[model samples]
Target: MGKVTGFMEYERLEEGYAPVQTRLKHHKEFVIGLKVDDAKVQAARCMDCGTPFCNSGCPVNNIIPDFNDLVYTNQWKNAATVLHSTNNFPEFTGRICPAPCEAACVLNVNDDPVGIKSIEHAIADRAWEEGWIVPQKAALRTGRKVAVVGSGPAGLAAAQQLARAGHDVTVFEKNDRIGGLLRYGIPDFKMEKTHIDRRVAQMEAEGVTFRTGVVVGEWPKGSKITNHAKETVSAEQLKSEFDAVLLAAGSEVSRDLPVPGRDLDGVHYAMEFLPQQNKVNAGDKLKGQTLATGKNVIVIGGGDTGSDCVGTSNRHGAKSVTQFELMPMPPEQENKPLVWPYWPTKLRTSSSHDEGCSREFAIATKEFVGEKGKLTALKTVQIEFRDGKLSEVAGSEKVWPADLVLLAMGFTNPMSQLLQSFGVDADARGNAKAGVDEKTGYKTSVDKVWAAGDVRRGQSLVVWAIREGRQAARAIDLALMGCTTLPR
Candidate 1:
């Protein structure tokens, strides 16, 4: 809108990155953000499409065109305002989100999509630099209390929204710090913890209370997931103390590969391996830490979690890294005309893959081979899908050397114990049973109890979690006061 022919005039400019060698040495953010002028130029590329598919394409439904126009017109503060209107944490999504919004851009039909994520990243960074971000304290206290379990993006967003609506909000996290998975599951190399810390500070200033190292319900014994809780508050206590309870406890049960030698000492879930390094980065000394240094690491799973394993292992100076995917390799380029306004199936090479990795596609691991209780190799075979069923190719068996194996397969469900403690019904997929309607959205079978994010929907992106949290908060606020001004 700023420049009529801006899309035709300028080529897409992407965020730069630190060289592989230089970045692998330290766990710090390596993305070089767009400069102010560069961001303005990039923002100018937003075509004045009557219908902005990018808005619907985004999980949180961000007002893309408004922010892009604001940025192009040098209205940095207003751009931040428009951004924060829909997204609570642009910094987080800008850095990690796959940018499905870009895929749906009108210009993407034939040309590169507008650099929306980069512009958003710029707006957020500039907002912080200019001190535009601050606490939005409530005008009056609502004489109600809310207990939000889990401090991940969902919980944090809900707590912040509820607190701003004048309710006393307390967020309980089992981990030693706030930010459930964002603080532990994601490595510091992709996004520093400082972003979470600052947001926590802002929320605290807005009257949201954070209780870390406090588990809201019983944690299963011997669970591989991280839990640093020193205190456990029973569900009865939360129910009796708080007027409303919101469960944003994320999906934590990692899917297991129940193959031979899975009990090997060197085979571990990605959650177990990732959280230790994050703790180490936070200056905590972990005993018997899982390290990939000088070890041949085999990461199973082809999702974001697996890519994360690749990046972290490389940072650990692994001897070599190989990733396995049961699915066949996708096309390097998507058929844009066929899938313009929706997410397309295509090959995605992450920064970690670019760093270094041997990616094997359509490969299935039949067994984990080990000696003396320690994993040593993997017995694998090429697979093909016939009649929608996977079958191993004949004479394609091979044994690959491996010192460590990380199962980066996605999570199966939220911790069942926590949901059971609240007497919440679970869906067929093991998510908390709750509707998304405006009247009964997020409300569980139990009165005064609700669920959102991964607890209600299955494991999803941070942006989706934030959207669910915000909507759940609005639902709770309306249920409490019979009306609410909070955005959905």
Candidate 2:
């Protein structure tokens, strides 16, 4: 807990952003982090609640109160230590996470909650600047090896935890670089990829081996998922080589809109559009790049993916950007009394949304209109949720000019072929079948093989992925060494 009277004394102060006009010129992070004194004040807003719900609200279960108290006392180093105790990467969550902890804050019952995320961002960034964040190499090797597929937050967290637990760890990524969604799915404007690069360096120093551009599954036709493997590692090979294998591969198969004109030249998936901009920002040459310059862009889907598309399109000097949501619009603010201690329903306006865009809800795209294989417009209709079913509103049909269309409807499941290749049974929603049971923890049908993160749980946040990775690492360590000291 922070100061006893701090909550009543201090008002909330939020982080700032660069003007859209200046930031639209380039693809880079424009977020203005909180000042040290201001962050301390914000941290002081944390009340001494008898039961801290923020801890449970956080996916990684970060010790929020302890860190907040430490920050209030200006014990910066101790704050960093406490912050990193549970979260493997607070920096990532600070920038990208929707911060459900704030929703669960006791003070949020009546007013703005404590700025936990800004304080976290400050702590992590300060730790790096003060050299508090460095590699902690294990004293002795456990003589156990773990092969983790995918270099996303889950894979990276598992590898780090297992390596620190004295097990040899190797992380494989299909892309030419590490950090799956962090590197490619997210735009640089939100969180620069350098945050991932530095963490990769630290993990390397901690004795974790990273093998990039090594695809783990069978190739999908006409898919953006790349296969750069010089050689493949069969499930049998992995079972024989490593003591245990953790499948941290994320759910990557994007949901598609197979409506007419989907194959139009100007239409593309959000993943395809987002990653190319990231690659270009990293100085990589992208052939046949998708640009929104001087074009009317229509981004389908109202999630974070659609927000990213809007931001990217603005940076591309697009003529206009519009986002569509199938569901009805939510209230501007949540009913806190009814939804307290849980994520509430509310309309979230992201920084990307603030930049520039038209947002429409309760709308459905009937079809994509195009001319000679090139996208020209979209046919849409308004819909209403009635009698537990969505019905099209008569006389609400309309056509909007669209030179580009980006589908950001989220994902359905993990890649099936990869799961089948390992003979792992999939759940009803196509995720790898695994449980949190200690006896059979995170293990699939096959012995010596396990699964975690989105591939096992379903499409989720990076913080959830990190938690799964750490928990899976603990399970694997326990299986290999007869016990594990790592936290679940």
Candidate 3:
């Protein structure tokens, strides 16, 4: 460690945000990351624990202590190398990951944990600025063809790994751009699309081919999630053309609230509203874009997506925003002794929550009340869990005015039609059936086909998606060459 007593001497310093009023006027990243010196100091706070739980806590299993020590010793370039060894896209994770690694930190038992995410953000940004990040072209060609479907974190990671291993890798994205959800679902206010674009350029240089606006299988007809695909390539074509196929298409079907008036004009899935804003940010003219301007917005479901809705609505100058959560409000702080070194149940207030919004907990919408086929209000009631069953409270029914209702509930599963087209079996939860064991890791029910990320594991964080992608790539490499040097 650079400073043995650094933990005792320093307090946790979080990245700053732009002023709410000023940031609302434009869609851009607002997080002010740590300076070089500050990042070094933050890295110094990493204690000499016998086991670095932060490594296990992180989905990608980043070498946290090694990077922390490297940063503390002023070895910025080496830190970036160590970071990239585990994570293909540290910039994406640094900006959006919830940092469960921090929750599992040794220091978090009694004090604030090291600012790992901020340090990672700094290291990646500095690496790019110093030209430490560049294309890693293969030394020789493997003469194998790999088709990776979807261009989100998982697919990108897999394609990069396979390409670096000398395979002819091609990524297919249904959206007009390379990044699947990252290019459209996430708002620019969180992370600009330039990050994705830069990586796409790097991957292209590494000999990975990107085919945008190309769907790999039959998209379900009339499915809202299939709106972006301009061209469809049958599953048979990919199977016959490629040596192997990796399905990294993320879970896209948003869970629906099948209540009365769900068919109302103003009621829409969060995806329906979010992608339009991202497209507009990318300079695309949306003829009938969904906007929250001067309207009473009601965001159903308390999660990252709901918080994103809150932030986007505020940026659109909504008259008012209210978020509803079916679960009861959690404690402000966790009981450290009871839940040490693991994610704890506690209240989380995002930057969006701090900006402005009303949050309602333990509330369930019974019906969407509207007039003339347009949403107007919601009939809701307080709920409670009793004897492992949810029951509505008597005499707690109420109606709230709403002009736009955004259903921000999480996704249920991947588009089943795509999986079925390739004859891949689905799990009980509707995710692709695949095992993560070393013997048959990421292999789908169908031969020569594999699945990873949200499509295989259900919806999850970007960090997890990257991890699955890397591991799946290793599995494919092993299957192809009878051995693989790539890390699992």
Candidate 4:
């Protein structure tokens, strides 16, 4: 709880963004975070609600109110301590998380919710600047070894947690660099990869070993899942080598549009387009890097990936950018009373949208129009729901010129070949079927093996991945030591 009557006295403040003209020139973070005084004022707005749904709403279960009060009282050191207690990387969630915790804020019932995210961002940045964050080397080493496949948030979180718990942790990443989804899936404008780099350094200091460019199992052909893997390790090798194993890869099987001209050049998955730009930004020379410069870019899908495409395209000096949404657009604002304390269906406009992009809702891409194996345009039609069934509207079909088409339709599941190589069983949705239960605890059917994050639960938020990773680490520690002190 913050100030007793602060909610009634102060108005909500939001994080600022750089102007489009300046930001479009480069792919770097443009967010202007709250200053110390501003963060204190924002934190003061937190009310002492008897039931704090925000805690439950957060995937990492951050002690939002406690930290808010600490910030309000200018107790930055204690605030950082409280924050780092539950969440391993508040900086990641602070920048990229949608802040479901704010949506579930007690004050959000009627007024603007507390600026929890902005405050978190401020705290994390300040903590880094003040040199308060450092590697926590474990005093005692457990002889147990944990092999975490994938260097995304989930794997990284699990690895860090296990390392802090005094276990030998080695993380495997197929990509040449670490941070799987965060490294490639997200655009630099939204979250600079440096945040990930610092954490990796900290984890390394903590004795966590990260082996990048090491692919576990088989890398599927024609996969857009960013494989710069120079080496390979079989599942059997890991199972025999490590005392325990965690399959924490991201859900990277992009959902394909099975339409005519699907194989046309200049059309690619969002993952493929995003990673190239990231590589380029990092000074990596890509021979045939996909370019949207001077081209009419059509981004299919209105989710975060689509927004990222729009932003990346704009940075590439694209002639035009248009995003398509299959479902009808929701209301501009959610009906709060109807969907309080939960994620609501509402039209979300990311900074990418503000950077110049046209958004079309309730549309379907029927086919890709091409000329000589090169993409030219998209044959699309407006869609409508009738009798609880989707049907295309008549006389609404149109062909839009598109020199570059990016499929941001999202992922279906983790790489099936990789999962199959490990003999992991997937659920109906093609996610590894592992439960977060007291008995099973993220364990797959295989012995001494566990699954967590997107690979097990399908594509989800980074916060969720961190939570699953931490919890699974606790489970594994308990399984290994018979008893554990790690938090769930």
The digit string of per-residue lDDT tens for model 2 on 275-371 reads: 9999999999988999999999999999999999999999898999999999999999999999998999899999888889999999999899988
Given candidate 1, what's the lDDT at residue 111? 94
lDDT (tens digit, per residue) of candidate 4 on 263-378: 99988999889999999888898898899999999999988899999999999999999999999999999999999999989999999999899999999999998989999999
- Stretches off by above 4 angstroms in model 3 are 220-228
Clash counts per candidate, in order, are 0, 0, 0, 0
Runs off by more than 4 Å, candidate 1: 219-227
- The predictions' CA RMSDs to the true structure, in order, are 1.2, 1.3, 1.1, 1.4
Which ranges of candidate 2 are over 4 A from the true structure? 217-228
Q: What is the overall TM-score of model 1 with all chains considered together?
A: 0.98
- Candidate order by decreasing lDDT: 3, 1, 4, 2
How many clashes show up in model 3? Answer: 0
* lDDT for residue 148 in candidate 2, whole number 0-100: 96
Instruction: List TM-score per model, in order.
Output: 0.98, 0.98, 0.98, 0.98
Per-residue lDDT over 310-334 for candidate 1, one digit per residue giving the tens place of the 0 to 100 score: 9999999999999999999999999
Mind sharing the TM-score for model 3?
A: 0.98
